[model samples]
Target chain A: MTTSKSNFSKPLILVTNDDGIDAKGINELIKMIDSLGEILVVAPDSPRSGQSSAISSGYPLRLIPVEKKEDFTSFKTNGTPVDCIKLALNFLCDRRPDLLVSGINHGSNAGVSVVYSGTMGAAIEGAIVGIPSAGFSLCSHNPDANFSACSDIVTFTCRKLLEQGLPQSVCLNINIPASDKINGVKVCRQAHGYWTEEYDRRTDPYGKDYFWLTGQFINLEPDNEETDEWALAHNYISVVPTTYDQSAIKYIDTTRNLFSE
Target chain B: MTTSKSNFSKPLILVTNDDGIDAKGINELIKMIDSLGEILVVAPDSPRSGQSSAISSGYPLRLIPVEKKEDFTSFKTNGTPVDCIKLALNFLCDRRPDLLVSGINHGSNAGVSVVYSGTMGAAIEGAIVGIPSAGFSLCSHNPDANFSACSDIVTFTCRKLLEQGLPQSVCLNINIPASDKINGVKVCRQAHGYWTEEYDRRTDPYGKDYFWLTGQFINLEPDNEETDEWALAHNYISVVPTTYDQSAIKYIDTTRNLFSE
Candidate 1:
């Protein structure tokens, strides 16, 4: 219950996610950061899956208070994970949090899925807005997955990140394996892997057409030991520093070499 | 009209973007890709701004064919740019193209916006399904951006990449300057930059509340020549090999060091 700190001395940590307030992953994550710093929790009101880094344009979203535990304050919003971070920054927070943490996501964002992950999307948004941010995920996709192993790792990693300081506008993508017995850690590259999209065709009860999103993940870079896929396979937790600059600079010269003459 | 490749057995390129089909930027990109390969076009029907990687969920996304000249078999999708790429891959492509190129986006995806970039997101999705994919973007947000100097660089870099091949699963993030001149290419990192959210509040015509998302981008890392920000600032095309792996392995020991007894 000791929440008071010399206002400037205690780093304020803002926590939010694509998974809504009640997800076990978030609950365990809250408990970890709760013991670390001055805490504020702003999360989506419902499971906003595959939301990517989307923000709302349809209507202005409103925030509602979630229960406050000892040392933690919680609020839920009807916005995307990106909105939660923005709302906390522009309205809810009294001052800027020194740190922003997202997810403890239900599944891995270790490969192509990072583009569709709301967890990392929010964290990336935080980093874009000058908040040192991060996104964490377990390697399991199960809704009620066990997060006990994730709890220990969250504290150690986020603390060190706070201590060491990350590269600017760069947030960490942390994916822990489901088994508690982890091998080690690797600063790995992303594997060449992607989902083969297969939409399920179905007829709704209203006699209308519907297509459900489903896909099987296939790793094209199986032999590549330096990638996140390799690390996760050996039970090593993977960390890849991700960012937003999407320019193909290497190919630029090669491309120019063809026509530049 | 000759549809046959007489003087060239160059690769066939499929170019598209989130910017509307008629965008000057896309037009410039098409000219560059056309020089290197036999090019085709498929893109969003209109601007899918901030749409992220959204695919159709409400209904079957109807695609209407876009009327264009020869050497261009085009279509406009009722979904995001990711949808356009999907349709190109599964339905439209006569055969698997040698490469799939996206964007020449009107703005920068420099820090955290990459995940939500319909341009980069499409290429990311393409890379997943076993195609060598890349997204090109100009740092300028102007609709009438003069993309003249960039053409030589784009052709050079993309041609090289298509020749040597990108490291598996790792695509190029190529960012060009808004300036008229150019510096050479720099293999740099993504700059540490972020947006501090400032939502523009307004009342709709129906007296309903609405908000337009707005924010200023702040770059925290300027002195680093190794970053895309510095490269673009110096009038160089910044190239960073970015991947989908968002793990934080560097912190496993850091976390373990902090928490484990």
Candidate 2:
């Protein structure tokens, strides 16, 4: 697993995820990426899935050092994924890491799911801070997902990213399918998608009505091979180049007309 | 304020924000928008300023209906701003809202701040579900900051969005400068920016090291008048058209080359 940098200067790799430090997915990711570089595992102390790019601003945050290993140093925070990244960059890391990787997320963070993804949130934060970053996810919600199938692809993608730098402030959202055997990787765009709301109403012990939030993710163009959703559906590892800039430049003019005085 | 909808059919407007329901900013917003339509306020129980587009998926969420007025309904959720919208759309509102408005936030969410804004998160969630949505912010961070300067602009923009409709899945991030009087509104692009981290480290009574994260928002292109940051600096109400589709379409080939076997 020793690559070019591993021999001369071990690249410092900062790893994080939404599924707390104890989750099996992140441990699997740590085991694989540790071989490539000196690792720093800074992640949330609790599950923060769907936490998006949230930061714990109102209250003072604390970063507790959990463990120190030969190849890796670990810390956990009572914060969101983005918070973990900020803490790692500011207080924990000795220097800016050579690479930042998030996840092996328990569930897929493709399509519209990116908007509420804490896994991609950390990666985006890494990109924001001028670090090369990537977020990996498998298309499985189960805690004990089969990660062996995607390990090679993950290693290859991370190695490729390290070898050939990504565009400035751009990060990668790589999603692998749940199958034991995988097709080759494909570079694709995010599929246009929405989640249909289906709330399950329930009553409390005191007889007050409440609701449980759950939905169905609907891909508008599911058949399009140019999208991440389609690629993942067909068992191909999908790599979508993502940027933090959310400006829809093409629609600025149309939007301007609405606000014209 | 009740121009046409209040008489025949009141348009339902879902109102939410990152700065809890009780924040002075949201109250000011609610007071203004209440006349235009039937308002449903579903905001977080506490402040969630930098919460981005986070959702509470790990635990069972509780949506407690607090107040019900003749033309307005209010609920507080133990969730993020995005959760407020999801709950509102699923259980609170009879149908999808005609318009979704977030904030009149106590501070500016301009430039790169849009990527980490809970106010914008609610708006983006609204847009994701195919609603006309916008997030408004004032340049002041004080809880009691005078929102008087930007109230009219907020009303005008929301009114304009309601009247003319935005592009599909595209929402607006409107940042109002803190000025006694404004120069008027200008639709602008998001300024390319980054936050330089300058963390404050501290130790607890037990003498363990921890840190409090803080940073300065630095505009990479400060001199560009075409950006939201520039527009706000010059006292213009800057409206930046925002979308959730994060795909860096231009860099797809560049990224693909890296993944080639």
lDDT of 2 by residue, A91-191 (tens): 66766688999998988999999989999999999888788899999899899877987799878877877777688879999998999768788999999
Error of 2 at A198 (Å): 4.2
Best-matching candidate per lDDT: 2
User: What is the lDDT of every predicted structure here?
Assistant: 0.72, 0.85
Candidate 2 steric clashes = 0
**For residues B43-125, could you state the per-residue lDDT of candidate 1 as single tens digits?**
88888766576555435654566777656667676667877776666555656677888888898765556656778777777
Best by DockQ: 2
Native contacts recovered, each model = 0.29, 0.80
Q: What is the TM-score of each candidate against the true structure?
A: 0.75, 0.94
Question: What is the TM-score of candidate 1?
Answer: 0.75
In order, the first chain's TM-score in every candidate is 0.91, 0.94
Residue pairs in candidate 2 whose N, alpha carbon or C atoms collide under 3 angstroms: none
Tell me the tens digit of each residue's lDDT in model 2 across B134-162. 99999999989988887787788778877
